[model samples]
Target: MRVFLLTALTMIAFAANSVLNRMALAGGGIDAASFGSIRLIAGAVMLGVLCALLRGGLTLGGRGRVAGVLALLVYIYGFSAAYTVLDAGLGALILFGVVQITMFAGSLVAREAVPPRRWIGAALAFAGLVWLLWPGAGPRISVVHGLLMAAAGVGWGVYSLAGRRSTDALRGTAANFILAAPLGVLIGLALPTGAAGTVIGAQGVALAILSGAVTSGLGYALWYNVLPRLASSVAAVAQLTVPVIAMAGGMIFLGESLSLQFVAASVLVLGGVAISVLPLQGLISRSSGS
Candidate 1:
C-alpha cells in the first residue's frame, strides 16, 4: 500500500512538472532552454544541499556515476527542447507513450515475464493515446516537438533503468544532477539567444525552481527508492498514470478543455495500466493456497 501510494504521488509530481513548464513557457516568462538550464541547476543545488545535510557528504565514482549523468543530461535537454513547439497535453502524451514503450521493451530485454493481461492493457493504453493525439482530434502537434518528447521519453526510460541499480537513490540522483547542471547551462548558452533574453523572467525562474527541486529532483529520488521493490513490467505499467494525471492538471490548472475522445482515451489508458500492473494471479494463488 505504501509503495502504491508513493508511486501515485510520484505520478502526480510528474504531472505537475508538465503543468508548471507549460505555465512558465506559455506565459512568456521563460524560454525552453533557459527553463531547462535553470531547472537543472536549481534541482542540483537543492538536492546537493539535502544530501550534505543528511549524509554529511556526497560523492560518485566509476561507471554508474557516468551513466547517471549522461542520462540526466539527455532527459533535461530533450524535455526542454520539446516544449518549444508542443502543446502541454500532447507533449505529455508523446513523452509517456515513448516511455511506456521503452520500459516495456526493457522488460523484454531483461527477460521479465510479461503476462497476457499486461500486454492487453498496454495495447489499450496505446489505443487511448492514439485516439487522443490523432491529428484533428485535440491539438495540432508538431513533428519536431513530438520527436523531441520521444527522445525525452527514451532518456527517462534509460534513467529509470539506471537508477534501479543504485544503492543510494538520493546520493546517486544528486550526483547525476550536479554533474549534469553545468552541461545544461552550456547548452542553454549555445541555443539561439533571442528566446533566452525575451522569454525568461522572475516568474519563470520560480516555476523552474519548483519543478526542479520539488517535483523532478525529489520525485525522481523517491521513484528510484521504490524501483528495486518493483518488477520492470510493474514499473512500465505504473507510468501509465503520468499522462492521464498531466492531462487532468492541464485541464484544471491550465484551463485546457477535455473532449469526449479525451475522456474515453483516459479510461482506456488507465484501465489498461490497472490491468497490466495488478497481481491478479497472486490473489488467486493466495486464495487457492489458503
Candidate 2:
C-alpha cells in the first residue's frame, strides 16, 4: 500500500509537470528556454537544500553520475522545446511512447529478464497511444516537435536506467540537478529564439518555480526511490499512465476537449499497465503454496 501510494504520487507529479510546462509555454507565461532554465535551477536549489538537511549533503560522483546528468539535460531541453509547438497531451504521448521503446530495448540489450506478459502489456499500451495520437485522432502533430519529444523520451529512459544504480536516491538526484543547473543555463542560451519565446513574465516565472521546485525536483527523487523496488519493464509500463493523466489535466486545466476515442484509448492504456505491473501471479502462487 505504501509503495503503491508513492508510485501513484510519482505518476501524478510526472503528469503535473507536463500540465505545468504547457501552461507556462502555451499560455505565453514564459519562453521555452527560460522555463527550462528556471526549472533546472529551481530543481537544483530545492534538491540541494533537501540533501543538505536530510541526506547529510550531496554526492557529486558516482558510477552513473555522468550519464544521469547528461540524460537529464537532454530531457529537460528537449521536453521544453517540444512543448513550444506540441500540445501538452500530444507531447506527452510522443515522449512516453519513445520512452517505452527505449526502456524496453535497453532491457533487451542489458539481457534483463522480461516476462512475455510484460511485453504484451507494453505493446497494448503503445498501440493505445498510437490510436490516440493517430493522424486526426486529436490535435495535429508537428513532425519536428514530435521528433523533439521522441528525443526527450530517449533521454528520460536513459536517465531512469542510470538512476536505478543509485546508492542513495536523494543524493544522486540532488547531484544531477545541481550539476545540470549551470549547464542548463548554457543550453537555454544556445536555444534558437524561433524555437521559444524571449519574453519573461511573472506568472511564467512562478509557474517555472513551481514546476522545478515541486513537481520535478521532489517528484523525481520520489520516483528514484520507487524505481529500485520495481522491475524495469514494470517501471516503464507504469509510466503509460502519465499521458492519460496529462490528457485529463489538459481537458480540465487547458480547456482541451475530451473525446470517446480518448476514453477508449485510456482504457487500453490502464488495462495494459495493470496487466504489466500487478502481482496477481505472485499472490496466487503464494496462496497455492501455503
Best by TM-score: 2
- Model 1 lDDT vs. the true structure? 0.78
Per-residue lDDT tens digits for candidate 2, residues 1-290, read: 88888998999999998899999988887898889999999999999998888888888999899999999999998999888777677777777766666777788889999888768867876776666556776445676776788789899989979987988888888999999999999989888857444868999999999999999888977887898898855775668679888988888999977666656776775666566556657868999999
- Among the numbered candidates, top lDDT falls to 2
The sequence of per-residue lDDT tens digits that candidate 1 reaches over residues 129-195 is 6665567764355666667777887888788788778778888888889888998898888876453
Instruction: Give all TM-scores, in the order shown.
Output: 0.82, 0.84
In model 2, how large is the Cα lDDT of residue 47? 94
lDDT against the true structure, each candidate: 0.78, 0.82
**Model 2 lDDT-worst window of ten:** 132-141
Instruction: Compute the lDDT of residue 70 as modeled in candidate 1.
Output: 79
